[model samples]
Target: MPDKFDTSLPPFDCLSDSQQQRLRDALDVAYFRAGETIIEADEACQQLYIIIKGSVEERAADGQEIFAHYTADDLFDVRAQLDARSRHHYQALEDTLCYLLPREHFIALYQSNSQFAAYFDGNLAQRQQLLDEAHQQQNLAEFILTKISDDNIQPCLIVPHDTNLTAVTQAMRDKRVDAALVKLNATPQYGIVTRTNLLHAVLLDSLPASTPVSQVATTPVISVNKGDFLFNAMLAMTRHKVKRVQVLDGDNVAGMLDLTQVLSLFSTHSHVLTLRIARAKTIDELALAAGSQHRLVETLFNNGIHTLFVMELIATVNEQIIEKAFQLVVPPEMHDRCCLIVMGSEGRGEQILKTDQDNALILQDGIDWPGCAQVMARLTQTLHQLGYPLCPGKVMVNNPQWVKPQSEWLHTLSDFVQAGTENAVMALAILADSHAVAGNRALLSPLQTHLHQLLADQELLLATFTRPALQFSVPLTLFGKLKTGKEGLDIKRGGIFPIVHGIRALALEHAIADNNTFARIDQLTRCRVLEPETASNLSEALKLFIKLRLRQQLGQQQDPQSRGMQQHLDISVLSRAERDLLRHSLHVVKKFKEWLGYHYQIRD
Candidate 1:
C-alpha cells in the first residue's frame, strides 16, 4: 500500500532518497472508523495526513454539510497543518487508513525541499502554473480531460409539454432551475425551455401567460451526447447560441449542461469576447470587437485550449460578425427572399480567423427586390471593413455571376456537372462546401439537393473533381523529411487542401451532406469507404495540419513586414514533437492521395 502511494513521487519527488527513508520510517499507519472525527474545527493540527485507503470529508462545524472530500493518495489539511490549527471538521467517510507524518518530520521536509514547500504553500494561480508545465515534464493535466458529466449536478427537470407558461415558470422557479426539459408523453418529442426563452416569449412576442411551454420552447433540442468531450459541449453551445444543452444518455435525458458550468470549468476569455461580437450594434462597435480577436486566440492557445475547440470558437465568432453584418444591410422582408451562404473554410466551420470572403446569394425565384445588388455591396463592404479580404475570384455577392435565382443555381449546377469544364468544376467545388449563414436556409437546401441528384451517377466527374488533390508535390523529400522552401513547406497547398478537397470530392460522390472534414471522415467510415483506422489517422492529420498552419500564420503576423507566408510552414521552427508529428502526418497525406487514386482508378 505504501509502495502504491509512493511518498517519493511528485510533490515529494524532489526529496532525496535519505529524506524519503526518514519520512518512511516515521510514517505511522493509522485507522479511523466511519463517522469518527479525525480533527475538530479550530483544533491544532499536529500531523500531516495522507490517505492510503477509503475517504474523508471536510465538513462544517455542525457536520451537516460536506465542504469537500479527499480519497486515496490525497493529502489533506496542509494549510491547517501549516497554521497549526484545523479549519474544519475532518471526519472519516468509511473505515479508513492514512499515513500520519509527525509535525517534526514534516517541518524537517518543509525546511529541506523548496519544490515540496512551494506546492503546499501555493494558491490556485501557483497550482495552475504547475499544471501549465505538466506537458513538458511527463505529468498530465487533469483539468484538460475533465468530463462534462462530472459537473452535471442538476438532474434534468422534466415537465409535461402541455404545462402552461405560468405553471412552467412557477415549477422552474420552485425547483431552482433556470431551464426545464419539456417532454411529450404521447410522441417522445422533447424540447428545451430556458429563462431566456420565457423572456422572448412573454416580453418580446407578447404571448399569453396561459400558452403551453412546448409552444414557446425550442424544438428539436440540440444536445451533446454523454461521454463527449466537455469542449464539444461548449463548442456546440457557441455554434447554436444556446445557454444550455441536454446531456443525452442514448436518447434518454441524463442531465442538463449549463453554459455557466462550462465557463467556470474553462475560465477562458474567448466566450466573453465572442459575446462582445454578438452584441455589437454597429460597424464601428463590431470592428472594435474584432480587433481583440488576435489577443483572444493567443490567450486561449497559451492556456492549452485544444486546436479543434479554438478553431470552432473562432469560426463561430466570424459567423456572428457576418450574420450581424447581413442583418444591418438586409431588411426583414428581403431575408426570406435570398439565402446568404459562405463556402470554403468558413462554411466547413474550421476557420480560426478572418480570411478572404467566399460567399454567394441564392435568391428565391420570382422575388421582386430591386435592392439586392445594393444590399450585397453593403454586406461585402462591411465584411471588408471587419478585416475579411475580398475573394480574388469575385465570388462575393456583389458579383452578379455568384448571385442568381434558385432556379438558375439549380440549372447552373446541372450544367457544371455535365460540362465538367475547369472553371465550372472549381465553382462546383466551392458550392459543395456552402452553408447558409443568414436568410432563408430553405431556399438553399433544395438547390443542394438538386446538385446531389445531378451528379449522383457521374463517376467520371467524381474522379475529375478529386484530381486537383494531386496538383501539388507531396512536400516531403525522398529521405522522408519535410521538403522546405526558402520560407518553409507550403502547408495548405501540400497538406491541408489535398485532404480537404479529396475528402470533399469523395463525399460528393457518396452524396454525404456534411461539410465539416471530420464529420465527412466519420460518415465515410460509417459507409465503409474508409476503414476506421484510416479515418482516425486522416482526422488526426487534418487537425495537425490546421494547428501547424495557425501557428505559422500567427508567427508570420508577429513580423509586420512579412508577406506571402499564409500557407508556408517553417519546419525549423517546429518543436521536436511537432516536427515528428508533421513528418508522420505528411506520410499519411501521401498515402491518402495514393489511396484516393487507387480507389478511383486514376493513375499517378
Candidate 2:
C-alpha cells in the first residue's frame, strides 16, 4: 500500500511521487534478533535500511567502538549503499525491524534526484544550508523583507523656499499628504515642513499666513535610500522621532514614506517601541520601554528576520538603553573622564534576549570623581529596573574591582597574566571581549593594547584560558545519540559556550580584535588561522546553537513557571528537522573541540 511507507523525512521527502512509488514498491520489511550482526565488515551492502522499530549500532571493524546508533525513523548505511560495501559491522541493539530499499533502485533514484543526492554527498555546512533554505521557503515572512521603492512611496509635494506657509499647507492638502518638501533656492538642500510645523508656525509663534514655510521647515531632511530595507526606514523614523521620512534614489528625491504605511505592514509598532527608548527622559520611562523589548524580539523573529540581524539590532537598542541610564546617573562633567564597558556576551554583541549584565567602567587617569562608585551602583540598579538581570559573578560596573583608572587597569591586566591562575585567565578572557558602550571610549584602548601585548606569545596563559572551553561535554553519546538531563539539554553549556569560548581563545591567540564570534571566525579565516571549510562549519554550528537556545528561552518566558528551564533544550519536543540539525551541529562541535585540544596540546 502507498500509505505503508512514510515519505515525510528529508532527502526522501524531496523525491517525486513516481520515484517514491517505485521506492515503496521495492521496499521490504526485514527483522533482526538482538545480538545479531546485520552487516559484517567488508560485506557487499545490497540494501539501504530505514529503521522502522527498535535500535541498531554501527560498530568499528573489530566491534570495539560504535560509530553511530540508529533508532526508529532513522536511516542507515547510506555510505555503504553508495560504496557497495560496508566498512563497519552493524548489529541490532535490540530486536530491530527496518524497511529495506534495494541498492539498484536506490542508486537509480539517487542518480536522478540532485536535491536528494546533495544531502548525503554534502558537508555539514552545505547540509545545514539546504535545510535552512527549505525552512525559509516555508516560514519566511514577506513583509519584513520588503524593500523601499516607488510602489510604497508617496509622491513628493515639492515647493520653493519662498512658498508661504498658507500656500504650502494648501499644497499639502491638495496632494493629500501630511508633509511637503521645501527646495531651498539658495542651496541644493531640501527641508521638510509637516502639518505640525505649519500649525506651530501659525498658532504657537503667531506667524502670519504669508510667512515663508522655509522659516519653520526642518533643514537637512532625514532620508533613507530607495534601495534600503523598509525595516530600516522604520528605524530611521523612530530614531529621529519623525512621522515621515524622505525617500531618495541616489541624490534625487524619490518620494516620502509615511509612518502609517510602515505601521500597516508592521503592526508590531517597532518604530514606536524604539522611539520610546530614544525619548525616555527618566529611568521609569526607560524601564517601560525596555519591558516591550522581548515582545519586539518575538515579533521580529516571527517575521522571519535572520537571528544575526536581530542580534545586531537588539544590541544597538540595548547599548542605547544602557547609555541613557549612564547619562542620567553620572554627572555631565564626569562623562568624558571615564568610559562604561560591557564584557562577555554583551560586549560581543551576540546576545539576542536580555541576559545578565556584564559591564565595567574604565576611568581616565587621575580623574577626581570620588562619587564614581555610587554613580555606577545607581546605573547598575537602573539597568536592573530596565530588565537586565544582574550578573551572578558581580562582573558589572557596580563592582569596585572592575572600575579602575587607565593606568591601574593596565597593571591589573598585567597582574592577571602574571598570576596565570585559572580564575585570572578566565577574567582576562572575559575582558578580551570588552566593548566600550559610552563616555570617553578612548580610555579603553591603551588598556586593551596593554592586555594584548601582555598576552602576546604567552602560550601557557592562552592554553589555560582555552582549557575551560572543554569543561563541559558536548552532551552526545559516542554513537551520536543525544545525551539529555533532568532539565533536558543545556545548549549553552553543551554547544554555545564551547564554540564561543573556543573561538574567543583562537581569536586572542591570533590577535584578532573583533569580539563577535561570527566576525572573529571571518577574521580567523582571513588570517589563515582557521581553514575556510572549518570556519564555515563553525559559523553554521554556532548560529544553529544560538537560534535553538533562543527558541527555548522564549518558550521559557512564555511559561513563567518554567523559568528554571532556561537554556535547556528539550529534545523530546524537537521537530525531525531540528533534531537532525542539532545532531549534525553537535558533531561539528565535537570535532572543533578535538581541534582545540590538539592545537592547545591539552589532553582530557
Candidate 3:
C-alpha cells in the first residue's frame, strides 16, 4: 500500500486481504525537510513513523547519535510506537517522506490483524526495554551526587592508637559499627579495625583488652574519596566484605561509610536481611533473614547481574544464614556433637534459583538426642518459610535416614560403593557433592576422604557414576529451527545435568573436592582429566544453558500467570540467538557424552 523506491518490509503474506487493507488505510504519509525534528527526547511518542523515502538521524542530547536511514517501507521510529517516553531526539537528515500510524490507528490495526500485531509486539517489547534502561541511566545521573556525598552519615567510629583492646571493644559496642578507625595523629593514616580482627586477637590469641589498639588495628586503611559515586564505595565494600569504609575529602578524613549505609542505599529489604543474618545473635533474626532468600534470587536474576556470580554470592549468603540459624536454634552443648551439610546444587554453589531443601546432618557418636528430631523439624519448617520447599523425597535434614553419625555416613558410602546399584549410585552422586554448610566441617571431611579412597578403584567409580552422565541425549536436531512442541527436552536433564554429572564423575576420580562446576572443569583440565577442547566446550555449554534458563526465569516474572512456574520455564520465549546458543551447547553436550561413553567403556 505504501512504497518509495528500493527498501521492502518483511512480507505480510500470512495476513488476510482485509487486514492488509486496514493497515494501508490507517497509514498517514507526511514529509519533512532536512534538519527537521521528527521527535524530541523525553517527549511522549504518540505515533509510529515508517520511512517511505530518505533518511533520518536519532541523537541523544549528550551528542550520541545513531543513523536510521530508510527507503520504501522501512521502520524508523518503532521505539516511539512502543515506549511512551522516547529517550532520543530524531531529526531528518534529508528530504524525507514517512508514513505516520497514530497510536489509536496502530492498535486498531493490531487488534484486527493478528500477524501484523505479532510483528510489532515482539520488536516493540525489546525497544521498550532499551528505552527503560536509558531512562534508568538518566535517573542514575540525577542521583549521582546524593549517592556519593556522605550527607546524613554518622561520624567515623574512632579509637586512639594507644587505646587498650577493652576501650576499642567498648567503642565498637557503643558505635554499633563492626570496626573502628584507630586515629593516630588526628589525620587518618595506617589504622583499621574489624570484628574479625577482634575475634582473632582477643579470643583466639587470648589477648587482653588492655592490649594496644595498634596491635589489632589493620594498617593501610581501605578508604574512598567523597567525590566517588556510592556505587564505587559499595563495590569496594562488596569486594572486601568489610563492614566499614573510611570516607575521605582529599587528604582529610570526612566520615565513615558503613556496610549498613551502603546496603541501605543499593539493596532491597531482602538484601538488608542478608546483612542482618551476618550480624544476627538469635535464631529468630536468622530465620527472618533466611525468609528473604527467594526474593533475593529473583531480584538478583532480574537485575541483569552475571548469573554465575549471583549463584555463588547467593550460596555464600545462604551458607551464612544457615550457619547463623543453626547457632541460634541448636543448643551450644550439641554444637560440637553435630555437623550440618548441604547437598546437591546448594553444595556445588550453583543454585541459580531457590528450590527444595537438600541437606543432611552428621552427629558425633555417644550423643543423645531426645530433642534432635524436633530441632530438625523446626529447622526444616523455618527453611520452608524462607522459600525453600521441603524435599518431596524427604531428603532434608529432618529425615532420620539422612541424619547420622560420621562413621555411619562413611559406612553408608562404603556400602553404596560396594553395592553399586542404581539407587546407591544416585545416593553416591548426591553425597559426593556434599559440602559443610554449618556445624563440624570435620564430619563432612571424612566423606570426602572415603570417596577419595573409593575412587582409587577406578573400575567401580566408572561403573557407578559414568552411566548417569549419558542418561539424556542432547537435542542436536533442534538446531537452527524453532522448537514447535510445548514440551522441549528438559534443559536440565538434556544438557545441564549430564555435564554436571559427568564433571562430578571426573572430579571424584581425580579426588577433586571442588564442588563448583566451573572449578571442577578447570581442575579437570589442569590435571589432564579432560582435554582442553572438551573442557572449553563444557564451559560454554554450561554458560549457555544457565543463560537460557535465567532468561526464561526473567520472562516468567513478567507474566502474572507464570510467576511460580519458573522451574517449568517456557523455552519458546527464547530469542533466535538464544535458540542457536542452546543448539550449539547441546551439540557440545552430545560430543561430551560420546567421549564419556568411549572413555568409560559403557556397553549401554
Candidate 4:
C-alpha cells in the first residue's frame, strides 16, 4: 500500500473519512510524461486512475481522436476498469500525475457503498452504449449475416431413400456444386449430400460416391416463413447454430434462404409490405395484408423513422384498406356513381391508431334507388369488421344524414356557410377536413370551394368557432409548478385538442387546404398565419399527444375491462423526462390559446 494519496481530487470528496483514508493508503502515484500512451486500444485494463493533473487524447481504432482534458480532479479509465477491455486508446497530452487503484481493490471498495457502486454502474452503462455503437459500425456485415431466414436452409444434407446418387450429384453440380434438396414430391421435404458427404462416402465408409445419393442424403429440413423479421431470423440462426435456413412461402418451399443474402436486405416494414403488395392478387388478399399496418407503425416508431414519413405511410395503408374494402363490397357500376369521403382524423391523415369510422358517401344525383341505403349499411358493417369500429355519434355510411348526392352536399354546405349560426359554424368546421377516400373526388371540390368562399369573412366564424380552442388553460398554478393530484391533466383537452383546433383555425383563415397536422402547420407558417417556432412546437406537441394516446389504446387492448373506458391511466408511469416534455408542450398550447382569445375578442 502506498501512503499519502491526494484527497483533493473532486471524485475523492464524496468518499467518507474512513473510505478516503483506505483509498489513500492503497493508491499508487504514477507520473507520466507528455505524449506517453497511458492505455492502448484493445489492451485489457487492470487498474483505475484518478487524475492528479493532466489532459489526455482518446482515439478510436481508426485513429479518430477526441481531446479529453482533465484538471486536478477528473476521473479517467473508469470505463476501461469496468469493461476490462481495452477498446480505446488514451495518450497523455500534458505532463501529469495520477493515483492508480487496482481493479480488484476498487471493486471491493465499491461493494461496501451502495451510492459509490451506483455511480460506477451508471458510468459503465453509458460506456457500454458507446462501445456498442462503435462495434455496430465496425462489424455491419456480420450483423447482417446473422439475420438470414431459417426456412431457406435444410436441417441436413440427405436425399430420399429411393433417389439415385448420379442424379443427386448432377443436381448439386447444376445448383453450384454444394448440395441438393431431396423430397418425395415436387416440394422439398429433405436434404441431400454435399462434397463433404461424397468424401465421407468414398473414403470413410468404403462406399462409392455414386452408390446412391439418397443413401447418404440427410433427412428433415430447417425452415422458416418469409414473414419473419430479420432479428427473429438472426435469433433462430443463433439458437439452432445453423448457417442456412429454408424460406417457405406458405406450405411449399419458395426458395433457399441463405443467412448472408437475407441479412443484406435490412428488411424494413415498408420493404416487407411492398413485397407483400406486389404479390397480392385480389381485394380480399390486399385487405388481409393490410393487417400488418400496426406492426409497421410500431417498427417506424422503434427505428426513429421520420414523423412525417410515418404519417404518410400510415395514410397510404389506410387508403389501401379502404380502397380494397370498397372494391370487394361495391358493385362495379356503383363504383363510378359514388364516392367515399373520410372526415375528422382519418381525412387529416394524422391517425396513428385505429379509431372509430368517420366517413360518408357522396353519390351522383341521377342513380338514387331504394337499395342505396342498404348497400351503404353493408359497407359500414364490413368496415367495422375490418377493425374500424362504428362512430358512436353515427357519423358514418350507415347514417342517411351523412350520405347524399353531390348536388345535395353542395346545397347543404352553401346553406351552412350562409347561415353562420353557432350550429352552422360547428358543422362547417367538421366539413372543412372532409377528403375523398374513394370514388368521384370531383364531388368534394365544389363543397371545398363553397366552404372556403364563406370562410373569407373571418370575423363571423372566428368569434363562434375559435373559442373552443381556448377552452382549457395550461395546468400551471401561481408558483409555476404543474398542478396535479388525483386526476392527471386532461392531455386531450388541455394540450392536444387545443393545438389541433388552433392550427385548423389558422388553416381555415388562410384557405390552406392541407388537412394533415404537420402539413397544415407548414402551410400556416408559410402564409404568415403562425410563427415558425410556434408551428414547430405545435407539431412536436401533437406528436407527443398522439404517442401517449397510442400507448393508452394499446394498454386498453390488453385488458377487457379497460377497453370500455377510453381514458388513459394515471400519469405516474411517465418518466421525469416525459413529464417535462408534456409540461413544455402544454405551455405552448397555452400561448396559442391566449393568441386565439385575443384575436377573436372573446370576453371569457
Best by TM-score: 2
lDDT measured at residue 332 in model 1 versus the true structure, 0 to 100:
82
Q: Candidate 4 on 470-523: residue-level lDDT in tens?
A: 777666554333455455556667667788787777778778888877888999
lDDT of 2 by residue, 314-360 (tens): 87778778888888778999899999999888999998888899999
Candidate 3 regions off by >4 Å?
Answer: 1-211, 214-271, 278-288, 478-485, 554-569
Better of 1 and 4 by TM-score: 1
Model 1 Cα lDDT, one tens digit per residue, 1-604: 2444485434666578888888778888899999998999999988999887888888777757665666666667877767888878888989989999888788889988886687666533233233334332221123445566745535878999889999988988999988898996556678889888998999999999999998887877778888877777777877777768888877778887877877776665556766877888888998898888888777666666667767877888888778878877799888878899999999999888677899999999999888888888988998999889898889899898999999999888988988998888898999999999988888889977887787788888888888899888788875455688987798898899999999998888889999999999999999999988778778878887887787777767767566467788877666433564576678888999999888788876
Q: Please give the lDDT score for candidate 1.
A: 0.80
lDDT-best of 2 and 4:
2
Error of 1 at 311 (Å): 2.1
TM-score of each: 0.73, 0.83, 0.62, 0.56
- Model 4 segments beyond 4 Å from truth? 1-266, 271-287, 483-487, 563-569
Top lDDT model: 2
Clashing residue pairs for model 3: 165-209, 166-209
What C-alpha lDDT, on a 0 to 100 scale, does residue 530 get in candidate 3? 86
- Local distance difference test scores for all models: 0.80, 0.85, 0.70, 0.67
